[model samples]
Target: MERIVLPGDVVWEREVFASGTWVKDGITYAKVPGMLRDEKFIPLEMAYRPKVGDNVVGIVVDERNAGYMVDLNLPYNGVIPTRKVRISLRLGGMVYGKIAFVDEVGNVDIGEVDKLPAGKLITVPASKVPRIIGKKSSMLNQIRDISGSSVFVGNNGYIWIGQKGNMQLVMKALDLIIRRAHTTGLTDQVAKYLDENR
Candidate 1:
């Protein structure tokens, strides 16, 4: 017989399964082929639900109300208030936050997490932040202009870049800028090279 599950249960094979499947505390669930039941449930409690105003990590699944709809890894989706965020967020924006409110209608609100000493979100540690800004912000500017992405560098070396529609190139450029920042006049050299090569 297939096992059963309740809400607030996490999927054991998180990387290999779909979201929103039912789970019970301390139990795992799997969909099995043609049996009395399709769900193979196991006891697992790793998945938990977020209470009202509790912070959590979520991905921006949809944008609305000048904010965003985030799948809080819970049974319900949460709203990250635009006011709670200081930047323009697009689909798939990764955010860490606390729950701000859970309305009677099942809508949840999320408040953005604080910026760490590195000046960007806490996810970017201070030690590696400098690599993104480059010396004197030159490489940073190049990334903004070339990728049409808005780049911000915090005084403490935290870097924030905003872009839409597949930002792999922008990400690569930012990484390169930060990694090569220490080279003498690397920004200027790149500028001159781009001018001549193009």
Candidate 2:
């Protein structure tokens, strides 16, 4: 059973894991209402916040004299300076890059980037990205091997499926993974789904 805690509720009197909690005068309180599981507070609602070193898939939406504005599938757009890019990208082009910095005001800066070929892009809840990749990338590898497609999963929840084999199947499998992410025994469930659909 999980324990539900409200905002400002004391989670621990001393030090604990820093996620989802704030410290005040040596006592840690819940920053958000959430379920306490495994000594971690799992918030009922969570949104993706860009962090440095996270790889992301972005679409070039607008070009500026100094850089390109990229849609990172997040609330804030990321800017990739022209000097940092090796290949020239046009509007609507896709690129894979790492977030280099996020300012205090939430503006994002993208680092070195590689332009990607035309492909289908899908968006899933950012929190479910780990489940899609699975342990040691087991789930992602399985999808690639079975579908014969190059799949790029961005930490920001944007997934790019290269145009290769069984695009529809790969999309379906990804959707299943996203939908069943919270359920236990999900890997087995995905395998069964693939078998039945293939």
Please provide TM-scores, in order, for all candidate models, with all chains considered together: 0.33, 0.85
- The alpha-carbon lDDT assigned to residue 129 of candidate 1 equals 41
Clash counts for the predictions, in order: 13, 0
Per-candidate Cα RMSD to the true structure, in Å, reads 15.5, 2.4
Q: Give stretches of model 1 more than 4 Å off.
A: 1-47, 114-198
lDDT of 2 by residue, 62-140 (tens): 9888899999998878999887765578899999999998998878989879889999998888878888898999998
Give candidate 2 regions above 4 Å deviation. 1-13, 24-29, 32-36, 40-44
Q: How far off is residue 173 in model 2, in Å?
A: 2.0
Task: Tell how far residue 23 is off in model 2, in angstroms.
Answer: 3.5
